[model samples]
Target chain A: EADIYQTPRYLVIGTGKKITLECSQTMGHDKMYWYQQDPGMELHLIHYSYGVNSTEKGDLSSESTVSRIRTEHFPLTLESARPSHTSQYLCASSLGRAETQYFGPGTRLLVL
Target chain B: QKEVEQDPGPLSVPEGAIVSLNCTYSNSAFQYFMWYRQYSRKGPELLMYTYSSGNKEDGRFTAQVDKSSKYISLFIRDSQPSDSATYLCAMSGQREAGKSTFGDGTTLTVKP
Candidate 1:
């Protein structure tokens, strides 16, 4: 099993509600990433962090923002959720750039 | 154009049959290739990782990378029913900041 952990394996929320998806890694990895995936489809990189206080947006445009105040923690926040935001969000971390990445269980979000 | 391309296959095969999954990448700068397996409603798990060109074997899984052709493959020997899942191919450059591009996963169903 991977060392990364994501809370609320499943979540259903109303539209326009503020939500935060938590991701934490105990493996002491420096590189963290967030990906959004539709059911049985490709995963799109949404956000990533190289180290503390360093975060960058990925190829895909996302309304959410992420912060990396600590090395082991990278949380994604959506100020106001929408129906289009319903998807599976995966969290992963790697020790370095070219190393193997470990993924968390993922958080499934549903907006109604 | 997208950096990585893969067949979104619902490939069905009998148990104990050898399974082959492949992906093609457009970026010549990509040197690290990886394959990840994701179960239903779960995050993806790394199955194989290879650097540059060559083949690497681990247990029932073998990863092959061809830098010249910008192609990579994952072969599973003696596939079992438990091996049924979505296989995703990912690749990226050496830089720590470069985002890893993932292909649309191929779903495999192994039947006994």
Candidate 2:
């Protein structure tokens, strides 16, 4: 089955902790994206990748970074987590730039 | 003003009722519109997608786009408890289809 997966569905970390969220898709998509969303709030794009070795910062400036080393994997890392970083991180992939995106189950991070 | 604006609705309705969700955009260049549904603590799943200005219906879900007014809507007939979730509206232009602008989602609950 074609699907996107994110690990560590729930996380709790203290301030200044380094953390990484893993995202992978089995659909062999070329476009991948990372979005930050608060519970019942708007979603903000944080990072995206057009293809392997191609990455760009999204509309919302984020403190995290992302890498697209392979077509199936796009991981997000926070250098130093803060309480303000407590939010849900969503990963999504698309076959093409104009195609609809399929999202993962999401990783919820709670930084204390 | 924001590129896309959506009312943050925590709307509660009885089961089998007709439910409507909407969003308005400030950009006239937007040509592609989409709706995504997110359950509690989960990533958004694409529900409806349309290009240009028109209406598209699939099963009990109907998506409408009015480019002249820069607005879009989603209507769900005979809403069920499974329909309880947050609905997000996203839009982008044909040329820059990868950079989609998203609106704040509206939360809906269908009670049995």
Candidate 3:
């Protein structure tokens, strides 16, 4: 099993609340990604990082931000959570850009 | 059109039966194809990966890629209830930090 982990496997919050989803890995990978998925839907990449201090937005426009302050840590922050932000957030890490990625257990958020 | 397309199947199969899942892509530039399995609220886990075209088999799972037709397939033999999960197909081109495009997952339920 992969060593990647996401904290607070499930979260329920109200609108306008600030929330941060934590993702960490012990694989020493340089490429990390964050994707949002609805129930039985396609995954939409929201943010990704090549390495520490390198972050980029993905194809899907999102209201979240991420920071890669450590190679093993990538955390996403939503300044103001809304009902539309309710979805499962997945974190993944790969040895390289095109390599197979290992995913965390995911955090399911329910914003009311 | 979406880069990758897959039927969102809530497919039900009996135990010990063979299950087939498929995905189609519109991007010819994609050089890597992968299959991921996600259980319940967990993040997706890589099940199989293929480069270019042809077939690759691992244990009870077989992955096939056909670049000419822009189609990919995954077959699971003797599938069990434990194999019940959502299957996602992903692909990406050769680029540094290339983001992968994913198809809407197919949910499989292997009944006992």
* Candidate 3, superposed: residue stretches over 4 Å from native: B96-98
State which candidate has the highest DockQ.
2
Q: What lDDT does the true structure give each of the candidates?
A: 0.91, 0.90, 0.92
Ranking by lDDT: 3, 1, 2
- Per-model TM-score on C-alpha atoms: 0.97, 0.96, 0.96
lDDT score for candidate 1 against the true structure: 0.91
- Residue A73 displacement in candidate 1 (angstroms): 1.0
Error of 1 at B29 (Å): 0.8
For candidate 2, lDDT tens digit of each residue in B1-112?
8999998788999999999999999888888899988888878888999999999999999999999998899999999999999998998887775667889999999999
lDDT of 3 by residue, B1-112 (tens): 8989997788999999999999999988899999999998788999998989999999999999999999999999999999999999999888743467888999999999
At residue B3, give the lDDT of candidate 1.
Answer: 83
lDDT of 2 at B49: 92
RMSD of 2: 1.3
Candidate 2 residue-wise lDDT, A1-112, digit = tens: 3399999999999999899999999988899999998877788999999899999999889999999999999999999999999999999888776757888999999999
User: Which pairs of residues clash in candidate 2, taking residues 3 or more apart in a chain or in different chains?
Assistant: none
In CAPRI terms, model 2 is classed as: medium
Tens-place lDDT digits, model 3, residues A1-112: 9999999899999999999999999999999999998887889989998889999998899999999999999999999999999999999998766668889999999999
Q: Model 2's A-chain: what TM-score?
A: 0.96
> What are the per-residue Cα lDDT tens digits for candidate 1 across B37-72?
999998999999888999999999999999999989
